[model samples]
Target: MVARRRHRLIQRRKMLGFSQEQLAHQIGVERSTVVRWESGEREPRPWQRPRLADVLEVSLEEVDELLAAQVNEEPEAERLDFAMRNPAAVDLVTVAHLAQRVQQLNAQYDAAPSASLLADAGHCHSQVTLLRGFAPNGRIRRELCVSTAESAILMGQLVWDASQRRDHAVSVQYFDQAISAAREIRDPILEAHAQLRKGFVALYGTKTPKEGLRLCNETAIVGRAGSNVLSGLGFLHVGEAYAMLGERHDCERALGAAEESFARIHNDDEALHMFSPTQFDRLAGSCYLFLGVNDKAEQILTRSARSLVRWKKSQSIVLSNLTLAYIRQGKLEEACGTLHEAIDLIAETRGGGGLNTAFTAGREMSPWRHEPWVQEISDRLFALMTT
Candidate 1:
């Protein structure tokens, strides 16, 4: 007489990298409707079942089977626990459960604070690592390695951001784990992604543009074997590193190459989901900022910020850089307004690069530092960082 959950259905959705909200949007239903369906309180209407199945990448009969299969409150959790206790018995379904959990955590990552996500991400990574050690030499082991690579990348990002980018060594260690896993699997896309993440620490945290540039070139080449998205993104950072080094011609060339790489992306590109329309603009704006072209930076950053509203971390950095552009143009009041907006987003996201950028913009407001508005904003940023 008790309501049950649809474990298989939920796992399928997460395994395919779709959050309940995303799945609902795809199926033209409210998120609560998807929630109810997963909770076994209500079934999808006949008209919606086909769309639901399509979103879930399941056949019509499989969709019905998933819906009719009543489940325990936390079947995935139970299976994972048992697998953890008896790792040698780990199978593909167990690997799917682990991968789905990691993906669910990743789904929540963008909007949430890194500190809030670190613990769960670390737990998932540890499980993946342990299972990898015990998994037999077969498809199950290979799948476990893939999950390890994914969870390692997530852990690296979480650790770096949670520490506000100060803890470089620990973050790099996790990224290395991912890179090693990718090499074992011979997966270029994953290898390039982990390498790019490691280079971010060098470029921003350590202030090493040359080292960052080296990493960018390496990843761009490695990415060529599989993913246009990673390659394009790598070139974008390559441009940023060139900008940091005051190499204008190389920066522009990198931008052009990035555009061409992006132009080649198809709907079925291996890493298409990572591609963002605003990425080029955001990095282009950074290039302009670095080159002391304040007007161009402001124009590009303003346009980029508009499309980046949904991504709090990236949008916050864009707003922070836009604040710098305003400051450089001697627009004190406008700079202060944009700084406040950036600070608000940073307070919500605790984005490491954005946090560092907001403070840098605040410090560069020295000409107007005597103003009460600037002083108040500085105080707010300090409070946000401490919290």
Candidate 2:
């Protein structure tokens, strides 16, 4: 017999755009194991439920509801719409549903065009904001506030990227709003991240390293109270800001502080997911490049490029920097070859950061524009621009 609980579970997974294999990969289970779970032949272990809950964007209790037999009830969407229309009726369940929707949208942001996600993301943010105003209980209100901050951060990233980093003021406004919500909730980690994003704008968008240094320092200080992932991340950028100012000694000192912070990050740290193994090398390489240490930059970026397999957007940026490192050292052929790899990633992800960096690397290779390989890359760049 087909279990009703299995049907609901399958339905929920599909509605959130997760195929069986995709969901299985996310939860670190075999496809066969996922099939057995959906067949109601087994239950996830207690230790596994948290990760499962995170992937499904539901609470542990709700994961149980999906595993057990159930009674007749309104579809979550119908109930959510009613709750949204009557905000005083909002509850934890409704808040959870909204949060899940945001997660679904965010999952697509890295791989999809920012313009494509803006309408749905904006609508969802509006609904969350409306519900936050009239949420019935303190607990419910707090949940909505968290959702607001999360959605606001996503909006800031999407808006900035969609504008090709041109709309700095608007994106900073969104980040500031997110910081306000985080502070109201007494969440230092959230506030620190929001500040760090603003630092990115100042450093890259406006080309102002002084302001970037101030904001990233603040993030590093606040993140220290939480986990080292954010603190290390803050100091990594701190080094970059110093490099932009052409202060090599200060940059290296900040990099040492960042490494020290990273050493303290344990497996169980809550912010571990925010870090990647190649991150330190990637930023350090870029810092050295800015400081005119091309040989050192090439060494670090080469290692980082080899290690970067995930986070394709970041991988592309690293490749672009690697290309620059090659060009500066008179390795024109190697530079062009590295750029091809970066361009492939840029084509796949359409990430603004990598796209911009790739162009910068292209401009630096102008001395050898007569070569066939150089012409080939220029053609690809033209196509990338039009598309």
Please report the candidate that would top lDDT against the real structure: 1
**Model 2, which residues run further than 4 Å from truth?**
1-70
Pairs with backbone N, CA or C atoms under 3 Å apart (clashes), candidate 1: none
Number of the predicted model whose TM-score against the real structure is largest: 1
lDDT of each: 0.88, 0.86
Q: What's the true lDDT of residue 385 in model 1?
A: 70
Model 1's number of clashes is 0
**Candidate 1 whole-model C-alpha lDDT, 0 to 1:** 0.88
- Model 1: per-residue lDDT, tens digit, 1-387? 677888778767776677899888889989999999999889899999989878776689989877885544446678788899999988655787998878788778779999999888888899999999998887678778888988999998888898989999999999999999999989999899999998898899889999999998888899989988999989999999999999999999999999999999887677887888999999999999999999999999999999998899999999999999999999888899999999999888898889999989988987777889989997998798779
Off by over 4 Å in 1: 1-14, 18-74
- Reference-based TM-score of each model: 0.85, 0.83
lDDT of 1 at 245: 96
